[model samples]
Target: MNNTHRQIAVIGGGLSGICSAYFLAAKGYEVAVIERRAHAAEEATFGNSGLLAPGAAMPLTLPGAFATFAGRFQEEPRVLLASGADFKRNRWMRQTRQAQQQRFAANKLRLTRLSAYGQELTRQLQEHYAMEHENSSGVFHLFRTPLEAARMASLQEGAQQCEVKHKTLDTAEIRLLEPAFSSEAALAGALYYPDDIAGNCVLFAKQMRNAAQELGVSFHFSSTVKSIQPEFGGRVALELESPHLDSRLTTDGVVLAAGMQTAELLRPLDTPLPMRALQSYSALVPVKNPDDAPNMALFDDSYKVAMTRLGNRIRITGLLGFMPPSQAIPPKALRNLLKIAGDYYPNAANYNQAHFWSSTIPILPNGMPLFGPTRHGNVFVNVGHGVTGWAAAVGSARVLADMVAGEKSAVDTEGFLPQDLAA
Candidate 1:
């Protein structure tokens, strides 16, 4: 490994930071990853839906987004509702409303470019790091109602404009793909994205961390970043506070990938970012009969449930809405999730021994994440990816790495500037 003196500090050891550090290390930059947790990806990144579905790339601020959200509001759990007093919700709503008009169309174009770029980056990592995480199984979207099925079919028109590969399947066709789904409420038809795949997010992060370490990148797990100060000559210093230590490190460059806890650190620097948290639930269940389980990952759009088969365990994760970070995962939300899962795939798994979990998704109101360098010299951000963090992390990391290394990017990042706002 080349011994480079240009040390770079990365805050947050989740998928975003790990991928950023790994890519920079690959380019011969000395990298240090400071994480608040005892292990990497212990937060939202640990148990994500794990879809590499770039085809699902659509801005959250679409023209009909409000209608879609309103229609499904009653069916969603109470904990998902945003509290009026929450500072994050207030900020997020302002930004979301601002993004509704012509601004949303521009955001969609940016997301399409970024997400497609992200998918390419993931493919590169699978080859570059030689890591295995149950990837390659395609993704399926099952529709319980004809109306829901029609909505998916309409989405295909937009998908075609982006050149995303997908297929529509009828009831018998879906059954042939997964025999376990025999319920009367079983989806009438489905939309399949062959390019989409699943994997263990935590395992992927661990493997990438290992690869980075092999190339001399340092990881300081459990080291919480206290503050960041802009220093002289285009550099920044990071203050770290943790149970066992208090220290500081100076770097030529810094990337803020901190999920929900990013606003405060940016506030001190006068680079306030619009971000919020949307909590979601997931359950891990062991398969009753291995053959009955679906080989391809499934996303039931109507019920908002997505299922992924991870070796011996089936990970069913979905149901999104706004919530405070400190609140515990609601019991009703968990029960509702299990009910939906059973309705979709009755024979796929036995929920008796399932383990329930919940985590927050860092969100920007428009559903587009802010990436690239901030106005402050040498400070960059790659957070607020919402539900697509794991899917988009590697690609965003690659773009940042290229920026840091003074190389040209394959994707155009014109709309991804750190502080760009819509009118």
Candidate 2:
């Protein structure tokens, strides 16, 4: 290790990468960010559902998740099981099912702590910089059927055990929360984490990048990562190929956060990171009437869709899991989204000019990120955030940075460490 002058290289310049770079630079380490995209936040960080939800601590493979998976198969343009026999898809389901057992109870406890700590980190960032990314509080989950409502009540109990605050409401209360919902299907609701917020992930990343740059963090956009070579004494040599030229760079340590491509990059390194590149779609539609837009974020339990209002733009993002990325937005998924939107908020019917966006969620079977140091002396991993990547980015970055620096973190990261999942 270079004691006098330490150079750190981070691959992938999305939210996780940027957050890692920001914290490293703040700690006075020389930082270099190598991004393949023409711009930052161009991949998974682009146009997300925009929920900075801290209460999203429930594991995706809860006991009742099998039931939800059954629901997923029935829905067209489905959000689960992209394609059967897809190596990644099969592995994810198998691993996810395995994680549902009691042996992994500690994992869920750690996840809850990390998520809660993440919420505090987000609050501090907002206050420290006064960023403008549509940070709205008040998140509600609406259920259409009694069974659906009952399912949520059970999940709420789990959430409560995690120390997340929530309240159950009847049909009239649901109406007060979002009067636009006229369908008799919406009979009950749950509102929790009044402080849980929403915002554009891309916007927040850009803002953080700007701040990081001011602190002397160097960002190399449009540079594609070609290879990573293990150098002498816990150092790394990075080969980068760009449109302009091919070049090699060296650093004391490396952080891999290349989203779905991370698995491909590390394959040759003999690190089997089993991950599912679950594809998800989102649309930003022009709002014809301001009244029709939701003032707060709402999760439609029946449809597995999340809707939020970003000023004049109403963003609806859902539909996860799929094989070959859909060439374009699936019509069935889009129609279902609009239908749900209209069902909950009648004014949303006036929505027009919807722009479709899709991203590959790097899903781990445990539904938690394979975050923290790898077996390699100088290498670290920070991808596989799944749907909660946006929510966990900043906090996880802080945790990973602390591990690289050999410091103890405020939150317990034992279960989230890469070695635990590698087992």
Candidate 3:
């Protein structure tokens, strides 16, 4: 991989694209990140529920997850919302159901592997840059129901096998760990992962982008990519709608990291992919009493919610968020989120003044991010990350850059190859 004058164009300046730019620049390649937004991390990466939990990287589509999803939708309509008839014909949903029934274990194993690798890569960036994402170590996955407690506790075995350090904490142990949680709460038990950490994902992306720019990476803001076409010897170029730029821009290579929009760009190249945007709701509440807040992160398996203390603010997120990207999240959706947050940490934050947000994370049916080169050779995709985008973006981008530079990847990217997902 001679990097004398090699250049690459990365679409989407979110976490994935910035990471690709950072890694490519580190490898001494001229990289340009063409972003549709005015700033980086202003999209899905902006308000992500920040958890680097490789110990629980399993997809939502477990063996019986479909039943749970269906029941949640029935019990609480706001938990999963569908706005159009197009949802019925969603190939990603259909394939997710099929894969859950057949390849559940395989999917979990692959995600776990990539997530673990990503966690390590993230630590390097933190050490090098002295990151300030409000990183707090250890996460408690609390269970309220007896069945769910037992079911989630079973993951302890797999975590051990994968060498992810963890602990099964009892009522007293959890109390000592984080005394902010109410003892009257109906938590049956908890699985504590000491290695897991929560941080501000948006800050991380912004810092990474700044670092890349410091190393000679260029960024194009408020730019829209119209099309991508293959050129001579399998190279690719992009057509843009910009004021101060040429309508068409040529690049030695391209990595599509624009969330669900990646599928649109690939469609023009006859490589249409199944990528769905699972909208997620997040709230940022200012903490009134920092001492009373849960210093550690908390994940409620039954409710599908997570709460963490980010500096003086508390962030809580829940729901599967299955709706059109353009659809505004109904104001009523906050009821469930408020209920769950109050049930766990009532006095930790001021929810009345909470800032509500919605983000659409790109997801594939199998719950694995698409990585590596495409059939066009010079085109690589780094989308379909879903909720794990924050956790795995850097590692995936590092490997993607390596592949673009014609070098062996630091992580095994076999199961997530483009042809591997072709059905």
Candidate 4:
């Protein structure tokens, strides 16, 4: 099947959808992106931590992870489980436990490979498009205690097995690399991944959108996809609703990359993906003291918070709350982020001028994204990336494009297909 002439509709305007549109357009496919927001990257992409750390992109369900999180819940209480979060009743939680017990090694390998491949593709795209988005190299994973470092045994082993370039840094080395780190804070050691990167995700998305547009891709901003139905002759019909017009657009295929809304769209097609929407929070503040601000990305292992330098500003993001979507940001999550910011670099940023935000991040049971085709022939999915969506976006998009074109993907496609979750 020659897919060069095929017209594909991508249902999202975030990083994943934009990357998919760009990759598909580059492959000679006629692509049209339908975005609900007036502008791109207004949701998850906008609030992304922007830490492209493939070395740290391990599955959350690693060995002893449950116990570690339990300890954290008892001590600091970073994870918030609201009233409606019934762990036993939630199928996603049940499958996550199963994966933790049985498929940790496999899932970790899959994610590591995809993350590394995504990093490569990101560089290639940046060079080809001559795009710059406040990019910075290297990431430091800081630990506050030896106990916290011990909890990462499985992660370290997995990184070693995957051949990820990393080195253990003592306190002196850590201080040498990040002189701005607060000396009063407790410091055990750090893991330095020199290959990882940090940059502005929204800027990258906009740049990719521009590249896609130059490749003859059409973008329909402020357009909403009301419904997607399979039509005759292997075509898909998208019922669109927008202020300008309401009509049905037909295409050869449909890619559901609408972040949290992807699950809702799949329900009508009888292909229910067991994905949970986890609320993530972030605070973006201007750098008050350049001498005290971080120069690159840093992840606090104890708090599970990521602080990344984006040009003159800093983005501090962390905390996963199992709660329903709301316009109001969780005060507890905000406090945790603020505490991390103050603890790491107290004089680096102005806390009063910080912009607080929250977004619903769709996560799967196995901590891996679902890509490629679904049960429906013309319907595909590229969602459930959790928080690593930014790290894995480009590779996932390339894999999806290869799948649609009936070509082999450069990386292994195992455990990423929608059918892999059927078990």
Best by lDDT: 4
How close is every model to the real structure, measured as TM-score?
0.87, 0.89, 0.91, 0.92
User: lDDT tens string, model 1, 86-159?
Assistant: 65555556667677444655665566557767777777777877878687567777766665465564457656
**Model 3, 1-423: lDDT tens per residue?**
234438789999999899999998988888899989888988878756788778756665422334534675454443465645564435556787797657666666666677788889888888998877689998888877686666564477568667899888887788898888777678877889888888888888889988999989999999999999988765677999976578899878888999877898999788978766677777888998777788988777765678878889988875566666654666655776777888867888888998887787777777777888778878889876655346777778888888877788767787788888864
Error of 2 at 250 (Å): 1.3
**For model 3, the run of ten residues with the poorest summed lDDT:** 60-69
Tell me, what's the RMSD of every candidate? 3.6, 3.0, 2.6, 2.6
Which digits, one per residue and each the tens of the lDDT, describe model 4 over residues 1-423? Answer: 346438999999988999999888878889999999999988778767787878767564322235534665443455656755475435556677788668876777788788888988888888988998788888888877786676466666777876888888876776698898777777777788888898887898899999989999888989999888998778888899976655988889989999878999989999988877778788999999999998978887666678999878999986677777788887777777888789878999988898988888887778788898998977999987655457787789999999899888988988999998876
Write down the lDDT that model 2 would get: 0.71
- Which sections of candidate 2 miss by over 4 Å? 1-5, 60-88, 101-108, 143-163, 187-189, 243-246
Clashing pairs in model 2, backbone N/Cα/C closer than 3 A = 79-320, 82-322, 144-185
> What's model 4's TM-score?
0.92
Instruction: Tell me the tens digit of each residue's lDDT in model 2 across 3-78.
Output: 3446788898998899888887887888888898888888888746777775644454422335545664355433
Task: Note the clash tally of each candidate.
Answer: 0, 3, 0, 0
Candidate 3's C-alpha runs over 4 A off are: 1-5, 60-78, 83-91, 144-154, 187-189, 326-328
lDDT of 2 at 45: 80
lDDT of model 4, residue 390:
75
lDDT of 2 at 230: 86
